[model samples]
Target: MARPDIVELPLAGAFHYRPHPHHDHRGSFSRLTCDETLRDAGMNTTWVQTNLSRTKARGTVRGMHYQKPPFDEIKLLTCLSGCVYDVLVDLRPDSPTFGQWTGIELDGAAADTLYIPSGLAHGFQTLSDDVTLHYSHSAAFSPDHQAGLSYRDPQVAIRWPLPITALSDRDAELPNLKILEEAL
Candidate 1:
């Protein structure tokens, strides 16, 4: 048999993905983060905060959020238990992908991950009854610097899998992308 070569694909500006290998029984494992892999992808940022969250129901939705300038953070997110429809929107005015959005389906079984660069708003909808998501943020959480766009905004129509059964009051009240652009 011949060995398989590893490759990275650019999903969007500053966002990349590489297939990971998984071994049996002890559950699966993947090197979702590696200095060499990151270096090759040309993403030169350090992560400082790692967070994990588990959802109890299928219709859970979170975010469409990011921090403001000077505190804008870059992130890497992975689904650890079930699955989710991950969404990202470019908020960088000067970025070529500005105002554009991308979506990816990630599942624990698939071991897929998503890389979100700074100046993007991110959110996800649970695709399974119970799901756990993990993320690493380059900056510490700052409530004062936190900002977001409405997940249901028509300007960037994101087709979530289900109606959000629950959302934080803050997340539900975020302005739309158009409002965000006007604020800039």
Candidate 2:
């Protein structure tokens, strides 16, 4: 597989990577990330941590979460199995698009990844059962720096594709944009 072709996403600092996967009788292989590719995009090439999550049920939503300054991080997100309706909300106070959001469908079979910049709260709804996601983070996690936004926030008004079947108690009670803006 060759280097992924990066496309600028609607949100400034966000990017979508379309990589060429090699397919043959033996199966397929794809390059999830490349240092030069990331460097060209002015993104952090050093990943401090890699996390894997597997959601068991469809229609379950996980996030609208971000980190505060000193721990805010860039992330490389990819769907490893099943599919998802991924979403991101701009939380950068100085950003022109602050309070705005964008959603994209990510298919597991597709060798694609999203370059998530700091100051963006991200979350996704599982489109199929047993969905797995991979995240490569530029900074280590800090409990004190963890933060989130409510999916029910009318201000952001995210139109999730499915009726949310499940959510963590914490995510359900997350504060809205107005409340988090000052801290973010």
Candidate 3:
């Protein structure tokens, strides 16, 4: 199998990976993930669940979501169709870069994946219609442990590339950073 090229992001434990895709007359084939490569990078996370999300409109925002300890998850996200501006925020209070955020553009054409470690918030905005995202998670979903920060919270202050055109009622009702900090 071909090895993936992993690029570390500014935030600790976050990575952008591009698999080595082989091109032939019919099409191309690539290994999306490799245990050896992940082990080499010290990111051998055991994924227990896989999820797929499809967004039909541009400027649609989803998440800034994470779960509390014991249920907090590590995610590997990839764009399956169309494009998106993926974002992540460091939520580990004890870490040096806590609350800082970074964004990356992912598209189906490039077939790159973003790896997000535990203790971080993950979200994204669709840049094109009919965008699809695939996720591999280390932990199972737990409603009781689920928590989120408002995507528009001033404290987190994410500058989404495009105007937010859509958001769920639950996401719109998420608490701000101050409240989250107090709870933490």
Identify the candidate with maximal lDDT: 2
Estimate every model's Cα lDDT from 0 to 1. 0.78, 0.91, 0.89
Question: What is the C-alpha lDDT profile of model 2 across 84-118, one tens digit per residue?
Answer: 99999999889999999999888889856888999
lDDT tens per residue, model 3, 1-184: 5688899999999999888789999998878887878889989568999999999999999998999989989999988889999999888989888878899999877787999999988899999999988999999999999999889988779999999999999999988888888876
Candidate 2 has an lDDT of 0.91
Q: Which stretches of candidate 2 lie over 4 Å from their true place?
A: none
Give per-residue lDDT, candidate 3, residue 113.
93
Model 3 weakest lDDT span, ten residues long: 36-45
Rank candidates by TM-score, best first. 2, 3, 1
Tell me the tens digit of each residue's lDDT in model 1 across 1-184. Answer: 1122333323354453544667787865566677666766676548899999888888888989999977899888778779888888888888777787777778877556777878888898888888988889989999889999999899888888787887889888999988899875
Q: Could you tell me every candidate's TM-score relative to the true structure?
A: 0.87, 0.97, 0.96
Provide the lDDT at 167 for model 3: 95
